[model samples]
Target: MHIAEGFLPPAHAIAWGVASAPFVVHGVRSLTREVREHPESTLLLGASGAFTFVLSALKLPSVTGSCSHPTGTGLGAILFRPPIMAVLGTITLLFQALLLAHGGLTTLGANVFSMAIVGPWAGYGVYRLLRRWDVPLMVTVFFGAFVADLSTYCVTSVQLALAFPDPGSGFLGALGKFGSIFAVTQIPLAVSEGLLTVIVMRLLVQSSRGELTRLGVLLTKSATAAAKSGAVAR
Candidate 1:
């Protein structure tokens, strides 16, 4: 979700920037180490960033001068981890703001927190939790994408509510209003993105099982092979 420029108060904007700085720094270090250890993943990283860029760029207007779109953080977070997703996501946001003008530079920090840091962490957490529960791989992937997309909008609603509270209802009321607006569009988009992510994950498992395995996208080589074998059978 893109928060338009000059929408946030100076204090709020600067505060978000300050809060997001450490995450970006940490993400850079984490991504650097991951690349060093697995040079082959560089292409995968680029692909993930591209996916994010394309999906997030399709913004639809929503309440409080914000917009709704798929965060597309789930696949990357599931494959590369949240820290690396944060770095990649920031880069995607930067390009979208600068080149596409879909988002703005002044509000980059707020956008990063919602779309990059929080969304990835939420999706990755849900994925890991569901996997621990022994859920099916496709189900896990679907929920990861769905939850991540919704979580990004949820965080964006909060940011808007905090920035522009309702006169009579205050932050809670404003949050509910903004959230309802986003939910109307974001829910279907989240579901669509979840399905798309499952398809992409299956394709990766089929054509690039080795890469998914190396990234630990599939927990075991045997599982990856089994998935491929099943696809072949189908």
Candidate 2:
């Protein structure tokens, strides 16, 4: 969920901005180096950005009046590097705020910290670790997405707690109430995202085997291909 502008107090925004600065810097530097050294990096990065925007537009209803959209970060990270995905996520969020009115400018940094920087890195980390395991790619993707989605909500909860410290609501209380709400919606949303990511991965492995190899998901490519082929025949 996009935190509206002015929803976060100025102090909270500034503080979180300060805290998240180093991670942002690291991501930018890492991406810049990749783009400069490898010519294809820039193009792939741009493509990921486009895909991120398109995926965000495809929303699934989570509750009566609200919806949750797939992040697309997991697929991006699987294809490219996590640092660039961070940049892509931030750029996507900015475009949504400016052109699509999905989020606000004042709260852009806060949203970036939570959804962009945190989600991609968290999911990518899990994927890297679990890629060696015996579990299915879909299952790994689901857990990676599950953690990423929940992490976004966790950071959002912290931001809200800091920005809107009700006279009676303590830190743990804020986490419980607000965090629980995101949990209810994001759990299913995460599962859906994982399933979509797995399907995409399977298709890519079958249609563009070389590309998946270049991206270093070759083992996963084989696994997903076999899994999909089996499912199709069944």
Candidate 3:
């Protein structure tokens, strides 16, 4: 969900900008390494972003608006890297706002922080954590997409609350309002995203030529790929 300008007070914008700064820096660094290490994957990276842009912008009927869309957080994190995904998303949102006006220009940073930066990072983090616990691939994907969507909505809701503190929309209330408005649409979409992410991840992991190539975990070609394959098998 793109937060329009005036959706949040100026203070909210500043606060989010400050919070997003570190992620931007870290993302840039991570992307640089990814490009350096896997030059062959840059095309794949761009394609991943295109997939996200299309999925996110496709008009899915929703109570709020058909504008409601799914982010490719899980897909990106599963295949590439989360930081790279953030940058890809930032580009997608920027262009979408400029050409389609799906979101506001002035609020680009704010929107980026909520949807591109925050959502993907949270999804990636949770996915990694669950992986450590031997969680199933399908379950991990579902949870990642679910968390990413909710996190974006939470940020959007909080921004709205900041704008109209008296909308009487506390965090939970805002969450309820936003969730209710989109739940019927989001629930099914999330399941779809999760399935898509899992299938893609499974495909990539299985087809990887080297051990380290598995799971995009950046390990030595043999050991890492073997480790990843073993994990996936479990």
Candidate 4:
């Protein structure tokens, strides 16, 4: 979800910008280190950024002053980790704001905070947790992408609610209203994104197995066997 230009109060906008600055700075450092250490990953990194840009640019009209779309952050988070995804996500958002007018400059921090910082971290958390539990790789991937997509909208709703709380019912009521409006389209969109992520992962597994394995996405044969056994035992 992208909040329209100037939709948020100046105070809230500045506050969100202040809140999001550190993560973006850290992300830049992380990305630089990644590219320096593993020059081979540069191509994949660009692909990840492109994926986020293309998917997020397909904005669907949803709540007023905002729209719903696939975040396309989870795949990068899974492959490159959340820190790297943060950099890619920020770049994607910046380009979209400038070129497509999907999001606004004023709201960039808020959007990056929700989609780049929180979404990737949240999705990667789920992915790691599920992997540790010996869940099927594709299944874990699907849920990870699903969470990442949905969480962005959830955070957007929270931001909106905080900025424009209902006069009579207050922050919680406003949160409920915004959350409900977003859910009307976001839920199914999340599921679709999850499935699409799985398909892309499948392709990567076939064509770029080495890279996927290097990224720790595709387990070694021994590890896969062990994980399968662990799942069976459970």
Scored by CA lDDT, what does every candidate get? 0.86, 0.73, 0.69, 0.88
Ranking of predictions according to TM-score:
4, 1, 2, 3
C-alpha TM-scores of all predictions: 0.89, 0.82, 0.79, 0.91
lDDT of 4 by residue, 1-234 (tens): 788888988888888899888988988998999899989999999988888877786666554545568999999999999988988998888987888887789999899899999999999999999999878999999999999999998999999999999999999999999888775568877887899899988888888998898888988899889878888898
What's the lDDT for residue 232 in model 3? 84
Better of 1 and 3 by lDDT: 1
Ranking by lDDT: 4, 1, 2, 3
Give candidate 1 misplaced runs (Cα > 4 Å): 59-67, 221-234
lDDT value for candidate 2?
Answer: 0.73
Q: Which runs of model 4 end up more than 4 angstroms from their true locations? A: 60-67, 222-234
Cα lDDT tens digits for candidate 3, 1-234: 687755656777677767766777778788889889878777667767877876787656655454467776666755665777777778888888888877776677787887777778788788788867868666776788667765765666666655554456466676566656555456656666666666665665676545324444434558757878998898
What does candidate 3 score in Cα RMSD to the true structure? Answer: 4.2
Task: Check candidate 4 and list the clashing pairs.
Answer: none
User: Each prediction's Cα RMSD?
Assistant: 5.4, 6.2, 4.2, 3.0
Candidate 3 displacement at residue 214 in angstroms: 5.1
Worst 10 residues of 1 by lDDT: 59-68
Off by over 4 Å in 3: 62-67, 167-175, 182-185, 206-234
The digit string of per-residue lDDT tens for model 2 on 1-234 reads: 678877777877677667666766877897888778776656656766776776667787775346777677777766776776777788888888899878788788898888887877788888777875556666776667666666776777777766666567677777676776665667667777777777766776677676656667675657678867877798
Pairs in steric clash, model 1: none
**What value of lDDT does candidate 4 attain over all alpha carbons?**
0.88
